[model samples]
Target: MHRLLVVLCISVALVAGAEQDVLELTDDNFNSVLKQHETTLVMFYAPWCGHCKRLKPEYAKAAELVKGDDPPIALAKVDCTEAGKETCGKFSVSGYPTLKIFRGDSVSQDYSGPREANGIVKYMRAQVGPASRNIKSIDEINKFLDTKDTTIFGFFEDPDVALAKLFVKFADKNREKYRFGHSNDPDVLAKYGETEKIVLFRAPHLANKFEETNVQFEGSSESELSTFVKENFHGLVGHRTQDTIRDFKNPLIVAYYSVDYVKNPKGTNYWRNRVLKVAKEFTNKATFAISAKDDFQHELNEYGYDFVGDKPVILARDEKNLKYALKEEFSVENLRDFVEKLLDGELEPYVKSEPIPENNNAPVKVAVAKNFDEVVINNNKDTLVEFYAPWCGHCKKLAPVFDEVAEKLENEEVDLVKMDATANDVPPEFNVRGFPTLFWLPKNQKDKPVAYNEGREVDDFIKYIAKHATNELNGFDRSGKSKKTEL
Candidate 1:
C-alpha cells in the first residue's frame, strides 16, 4: 500500500510538471542526469508540500528563462518521498522543499537568492558571467556603480598584473553575492590610480558622507578581500531591509526608524548620523544597522512596541539568540550606554512573556516565558509541554483532546504544561517552528526533550509516557489508564 502511494505521488507530480519546463529526477538517474548540465538548480521536494506546490509555477517560469543559458543551467525537481528518496537522503534534505545549486562534483551551496522567476533568472545569469565585467569608459564605470548591489571594481596598470589575476579568481568565486568589474585602460586607471588596486563600491542606496563611498582593498589574498568586503559592505550605519536582515551578523544593535533613501534622504541620514556616532564608539564589539520602522512595524508590534511614538526604538540581539529592546530618545551618550550594558550583560532581556499566572495548580498548567524555567525546566517532574500559538487552528482543534489527557494523568508525577508560543520567548533548546508542537521532557533527562510526534489522541500520549517516563504511575497503568497496571 505504501509503495503504491509513493508511485501515485510521483505520477501526480510528473503530470503537474508535464506542461512546465522542469525535469522530473529520480534516484535511478539522479547522478547521471545532473552531470549532463554544468549548473542545475535541483529542488528536493515532496509532492504533498504546500510551499513546493506554490513555488512550482515560479520555478517553471525560471526554468524557461534559463533554458538558453550557456554551460547549460537546468532547473529540476526530485520527489523526496518516492523517486528520489535515496538521493534526498544522501543530500540530507530534511525539509519538504529544499533548493540546492549543483555544479558537477563541487560542494553544493544553498540557493539563497529570490524565488520569483525574474529574480531567479537574473541570479543564475550572474553565475555564468565573466569573472569581472570590462569597464572601457568612465561612463561604464559610473553605470556599474549605480546599482543597488555592492560592486567591486579593480584597476591595474596592466590587465595581466598578478593582483588583477587574483581579483578575477575572487570575483569568479563570489559572483553570486557581489558584482565585479575591471578596467586596465590608462584613462580609467587615471581616474582612480595608476597602480593595481581594488575599490569596493558599497551599494548606492547606502551612500552617505559618514563613510567613504568606495573602500580600498589593501590586502593581496582572496581571504583578505573577503574580510574587507564583509566588514565595509554595510558602511558605518547599515541600511537593513527585509531582504538584507539575515546578512547582518549577530551581536547586532539595530535602530528602527524612518529609513527612506528615496524620499527623505537627508532626514534618513539625520537619525543614521546619530547611530553612526555610537556605532563608531564600538567598532568591533557589535555590528550596527538601521531598519525602516514601517517595514518592520508588524515585528515591533509583537514586541509590545505598538502605539509607541516615532522615537527610534533600539533593539539588540547577541550571538546567544537573546533579545533586548529600548524605546527611548537616542543620544550619542545614551545609545552607547545601552550597547555597553548589553555587552556587559547588565540589561534584562526583552522577552515576549505573558504575565505569570497567580494560580497554575490545574490539571493542565500554563507556562509563560517568565515562569517557564520554574514550571517546566527546573521542576522535579517529567513534563509534557505544548508550545502553541493562539491563532493556530490545529492548536484549537487539539485543545479538548490535550485537556482530556491532562485530566487522566493528573494523579501522575508529571507536568502537562501548555504555553502560548507567540507571547513567549522559548529557550533555544526547544526549537518550536510550528503551532501545536509537543515535547516530552523526562524528569531525569531534562536536557534532552523528545518531540511528541505520535497521534493527538489521549491513548497515544499515554503510550509515549509509559515507554519514556522516568517513574511508574501509582495504581494507574503506564499506557494512560486508571485502576490496575496494564503491562
Candidate 2:
C-alpha cells in the first residue's frame, strides 16, 4: 500500500510539472518578450532552493490556470543555479519562487513564499505585490528598522506555540509591514543579546552612531520583551520630513510614533523619543513637537494646522498652505528620509479636503489685466491662467492639475493665476465663451496663443510653458534635455 501511494504521488507530480510550457529566459529576448506580452510571470529560482523545487510544478499548474482566464500569462523561469546570476541581482531576488509580474514594460507585482499552483494562480489573479518576507540577517533587520514605512521585527527563540501566539496576536493588524523571524543558532542569539558585538558580526564596518542600537534586553514576558524591543528599536522606521511636510513658515509640526501603540508608560516614552529624534533633524527647517498629553488638537488650533491621523501626525505649512503628509508610525530617520524623497520629487501629497480661504478669489493684485495689452505671454516663464466655474466637472479635474502645476512651478517665476468668469467683479468684456479655457502665456512670443483648445493636455501645456516661459531665475535644470514635470 505504501509503494502504491508513493507511485501515485510521483505520477501526480509528473503530470502537474508537464501541465505548462516554461520558457527559459536569457539576456537576449527578455525585454522583447516582456514588452510584447500584457502579463508575464518571471520566476527566479535556484536548484538549492527547497522552496523553489516544491514550487516548480505548482507554478506550472498556476500558469495553465491563469492562461485559461486571461489569454494566459506567459511563464518563464530563470535558474540562479545556472547563468542567471545578474538577472537575480537585478530583481533584488534574495529568495526563490521570487515571482515578478510585468504588465508591459513596468513591474506591477512580486511574490516570494511557499506557494502551490493554486496559490500562485490566486495571487496572480489579484495582481498585487506579494507579501514581503521577513528580514533574515541583522543588517536586513536594521534596514527594516530604518525604513520610513511601519515595520515590525519579531525575535523568536523557536517557531513554537508561544511565538505562534504572538504572530496571531499582531499579524492580522500589522500584516506585511511586520517582520516575524527566529534563530536556533546559539552563536547568533548571544551576539544580538547585549552589545555592539552582534552588529560587528552582522555589519563589521557600521558607524558608531548607527551601531549604537545594538543592545541587551532584560525581560521574560511577551509584553516586557515587546516593550523593550519597540522602545529601543521601533523609531528606526521611516517618517515624513520637513521638505514634504510643508512649505509654510508656520512650523512643520509632527508627532512621531511606532505604528503599534501599547497603552503603557514605557511604550509612550519610547514613542516620544522617536518623535523627538525625527523633530530634531529638521530643527530650523520647521517647528517640531510631540502628541504627548493628547495636546495635538490644542497645538494645531493654536498654530493653524492640517494633518492626518492620531498616531503620528505631521502638520506643515508655509505662509499660505497647511498640508498633511502621511498617517503612520513616525521617526527622525523617516522625517529626513521623506525629505530626501521630496528632493528626489518622489513624495506625493494627497488632497483630503480643500481649504475654503476667506477670499477664494482674492484680487489679482500681482498683475492687472489690461485690454489688448499684447495678451502678455511668456514661455521662458510658464504663465498659466485659467477661466472656470466651481460647479463644472471638467473644471474640478483641471483645478487639481492647476494646483499641481503651480506647486511644481513654485520657484520658477511661473505666473499662475485663475479668473472666475462667473464672478461679477471681472469685466464682462473678458468674454470667454467656453467654461474653462486655459491661457498658456509662454516667454517666447512666437508661440503665442492664437486660439483656444478646450482639452486636458498636461504634457502639451507644460511644453508650451517651458518653450515660451523666460526662466530668468535659472530654475529649470538645463543640463539635460528639457524634461517637463508631470503635474
Candidate 3:
C-alpha cells in the first residue's frame, strides 16, 4: 500500500509539471493543427540555439496564460532541427526561434516584439483583431481611457488623411505596449482639445492619477512623429531617431553600429550584452541609446563624423552644450572611462571642424595628430599644450595670451605648444572634448599629463608652468613672485 501511494504521488507531480498549454507540432500535423485553431502563434526553433533555449520557458508561461482566453488562442512550437525542416523552410526561418502568427488559415504576420511572457501574451491578444480601434462617439472615448493605461488617439477631419494612415501603421507595430484609437468625429475632437490631426493621450493610472494630457504631433515627417511617440512612451535605452534628439534633456551616450543577426549572431548581442551593461550601471546619470548608421546619417554629419567609416562610434552629449566622442576603440573598460570623465566634468567638448593654425613663429610650437606622440611624448622637456579649435571665440581670445606666456618661458627648458584638435587627433589621455583645452606634461616620463583648468591669463600660465618645470627658475619663487629659486 505504501509503495502504491508513493507511485501515485510521483505520477501526479510529473503530470502537473508537464507543459500541456503548448502544442508540439511536426511537419505531418502542422497543416492539420492550423485548420483546427482560428488563431495560432507558431514558433520555429532549432535545438542548439542559446536564444531559443532562453525563450522556451517564457514562451511556455505565456502559452499557459493565453490558454483560457475567450477565443482560446493556440500556442505551438516546431523543432526545425528534427521533423520541421520543410515547414521552417516554407516560412524562411533563417534565424532561430522565429515567431509567426496564422489567422483563418490565410492571414499571417511576423511577431517582432518583446520576448518576455507578459509581452508575448499582450502582443498575441492584440493580434486577434485590428490593433487600433475606431472611436465613433464621445462615450467610447471615456470608456476607452478608463480601461487603458495609455492610449494614443488620432483625430482628423477625414479617415483618408495621410496622418491617420501613418498612425495606423505605427499602432499596428506597437499595439502590444500601447492602446491606439482613431476618430473623425468633431465632438470627440473638441472634447480632447485637439486642433491637430493626431495626439497622444496619457490615461490616469496608479503611477499617475492626474487627468489625461494631450501630446500634439507637430512634425511633418512620419519618422519624426514616430520617434516622438516612442521617446515619450518607452523606457531608457531606446532607438535614437531624429525626432528624439530634440527631447533629450539628460546626458546622452549613443552607440552607432550595424547589427547583422544572420551573419553574426554575436554581433547582434553586442547591444544587449555589452552596451546594456554600461547603461544599467549608469541608469540614473545618463540615457544610453543605439541608432542604426543608415537611419541617422544626417545627424551624424552634423557632428562631423562619417558613420560609414567607423563602425560603432561612441559619443556623449550633455546638457551643458558639450559633445564628446570616444577617442579609443570600443570596449567595456574604454566606455566606462569615457562615461566617468563625462560625469566628473573632465571631458572637452567636440567641435565640427577647424582649420590648422599657421606657424606664427611664436615661442609656442604647433602639434598635429600624426606627430602628437613624437612632439609631446618623446620629448624630455616639460610640455604645456593647448588643444584648440579655430572657430571657437574663447580660443581666439586665449591665442594672444598663450603666445605672451610662451614668449615669457622661451628661455626655460619647458616647451609650449598648441594644436587644432578638430583637424588633428590627440592621445586619449588628453580628453579633448571642448575648445582651448590645456594640459601640462611633466618632464619625467613616469608622470601623466595634468589638465590645466586655471585662468588662461599670461601670469596664470607662467605660474603653472614654472611650478611644474623640472629645473628651478631663476626669476620666480614658489608663489610666482620675482624671487630667485635654486635648482
Cα-based lDDT at residue 229, candidate 2? 43
lDDT of each: 0.82, 0.51, 0.73
The best-first sequence of candidates by TM-score reads 1, 3, 2
Clash number for each model: 0, 30, 5
Tens-digit lDDT string for candidate 3 (95-159): 98899888755438898766867668777877776777777889987887774245677887766
Tens digits of per-residue lDDT for model 2, 1-487: 9999999999888766665466677656677767877777888888788888777877777666666453346777888767777777877888776888788746777754336664455445434232323445666554545522233334555656564345445544333223333343445455456321111111112112322434444544557655654443323222222212221234344553333233453554455555556644654455543443242454444333344344555544332233445444455566667654543446553333222233433222122232113223422444566777768788888776666655655656665666554431222224467767666555455245433363465554555555555563344443313456677
Query: For model 1, what is the alpha-carbon lDDT of residue 395?
Result: 98
Q: Which stretches of candidate 1 lie over 4 Å from their true place?
A: 1-112, 115-131, 157-165, 204-210, 219-221, 307-310, 475-487
- Point out where model 3 deviates above 4 Å: 1-19, 46-49, 64-73, 80-95, 104-111, 118-128, 137-143, 146-149, 160-179, 184-197, 203-213, 219-224, 234-487
Per-residue alpha-carbon lDDT of model 1 for 1-487, expressed as tens digits? 9999999999778656543778888989887887777788888888889999877877887887777765467888999999888998998999967998888634368888877665676677677648688888888887878875778888887768888888989888877667788987777888887578999888877776667888898998988988988898888778887656776888999888878777897788888888988887888889999988887887677667875355578888877878888755777778999999988888888888899999998889999999999999888999999999999999999898889878888888888999998888888789899999999999888889888899988788877777677888763566656565468
Question: Would you give me the overall lDDT of model 1?
Answer: 0.82
Best by lDDT: 1
Which scores better on lDDT, 2 or 3? 3
